[model samples]
Target: MLKKSHLLCLCFSSTLLSGVAIAQNAVIVNGKAIPKTQLDKLVQKSGQPDNPQVRDQAREMLVTRELIIQEADKRGVIQKESVREQLEQSRVGVLVAAVFEDYVEKEGVTEAELKATYESMKSQYSGKEYHVEHILVEKESDAKAIIAQIKSGGNFEDIAKAKSKDPGSAPNGGDLGYVNEKSLVPEFSKAMVQLKNGQVSD
Candidate 1:
């Protein structure tokens, strides 16, 4: 036989306690417990509105990520040989890059040093580029004959396709892309440099 006021107070106390427990159990991020706050922050950072549709999409994405992480954990993917190897490689790469960066900073690469290096090694870099066609023959004699045919206004590409031993260049009509002196063998490069543009050689 509780009084009406006492009964009301007891009910109110129970309700308040339950609310406090719920609040305590709730997870918070950035000192905020409201989902909308979280959504707003995400939207702000991403430059997109977390509308109902977007929220639903994000929820699905989070759920999928969680499921993947859970499955990975269960399957010990993090401890797998392949995964560990990849991680080790990544770690080594990062460490090497960091060390190189530190060394470069300490050594101080100057503009003058760079320019000097470039100038001294200019011949190593300098070369004439050519786009030439040729016929590759087994004997120097056959090659010489092909060169003669070319001098007599015969089509270099046609001759190459007809008699070139090199399968790779034969199909392309012996068209080698723009190659420089450095790109060719010593003898080949010397011969190439002696020729003018569009000139064929043995």
Candidate 2:
């Protein structure tokens, strides 16, 4: 049977919902106290504004969840592999979060520490950026022919705009403006770095 406090928490404040308050600080469910902190989190997660309708809905949901959980525990349904694994995941997730919280609280981040960390991994934030142009084709033979044409005095942009298959850059004459070297594929970046200004890749 649902406790008086449980009904109160699950129902609207009005008598129409059969609500009966028993505790001022917590929702009592099957003689177990569900703390206000945990209850607030549950309500917040419901994504409902703090109004009578949402409050009542959140309460009903929490009550139903508790009842189902209690029934499952009593009947050993939680012992099944799937249920156990689900519960284990929840437990581990909570514990992991708690550990991170505790560690951060104990050894708080300082501006100096942040700067030091940033400096240590500055390569991630700082790199050689490049402006590039390329002709993309479906076949290697097409690429080789295109490269030969460029070598023989074809305008790279005109050729790229006419024949490059990469729709995004093709319209813009294959102009890839100020690319960070690290963002490109390894082989592409290697080839690109070998070229001087306004030089086309072979």
Candidate 3:
């Protein structure tokens, strides 16, 4: 019984409402509208297969975390000096990491820079590759102590397993396997090329 104009109007209204709902993908918790992006980010971080179950779990986690945060705010836990400092540090770390990632993606090494680096290190890359192992520590004092221990016949692999902070290589005795010298950072390449086989840098 609807007129042609009324039917067209109804269709238009339905299309707009559907578009808005699809764009928002809103998940409401109490009165809050949690963004779908947060759920997507959580799932990506979990490294799990993206399926309904994983999404449900992520949604539950977000809701619980939000509830706890709300409770903390109500009790003024965020006002504590130590908590404020920790939160600020976490914020800085996240922002700095994001900047580094964005910068690397948008400003990757140019061909000219690569050519210059290659030219400077051509001697080190004379058709010979090197297998590299390294133990990384935060302090020069720690590095010196490790070097001393190695000089006195302490096992390099054992020391690497115990002290190296590099998660990817530490478990494998700090072994980076075979690598092209040019692929290494300049300082590392310079030091590595100076070492004789089976010799550790002083």
| Residue-level lDDT tens digits of model 1 in 21-57 | 4444222322323343444455457666757677656
Q: Is candidate 1 or candidate 3 better by lDDT?
A: 3
Tell me the tens digit of each residue's lDDT in model 2 across 48-110: 777767766766666677777777777788888867887899999999999988978998878
Ordered from best to worst lDDT, the candidate numbers read 3, 2, 1
Q: Estimate each model's TM-score.
A: 0.38, 0.42, 0.40
Residue pairs with backbone atoms closer than 3 Å in model 3 (clashes): none
> How many Å off is the CA of 7 in candidate 3?
64
What's the C-alpha lDDT at position 169 in model 2?
Answer: 89
Model 2, C-alpha of 158: deviation from truth (Å): 0.8
Rank order (by TM-score, best first):
2, 3, 1
- Segments of candidate 2 deviating more than 4 angstroms: 1-122
Top candidate by TM-score: 2
For 1-202, candidate 3 gives per-residue lDDT tens digits of 2465673221111111135654564366555667778888999999999999998899778877766676667779899886898899999999999997897799987789889989877866667688999999999999999999999999999999999998778888999999877788999989999999998997
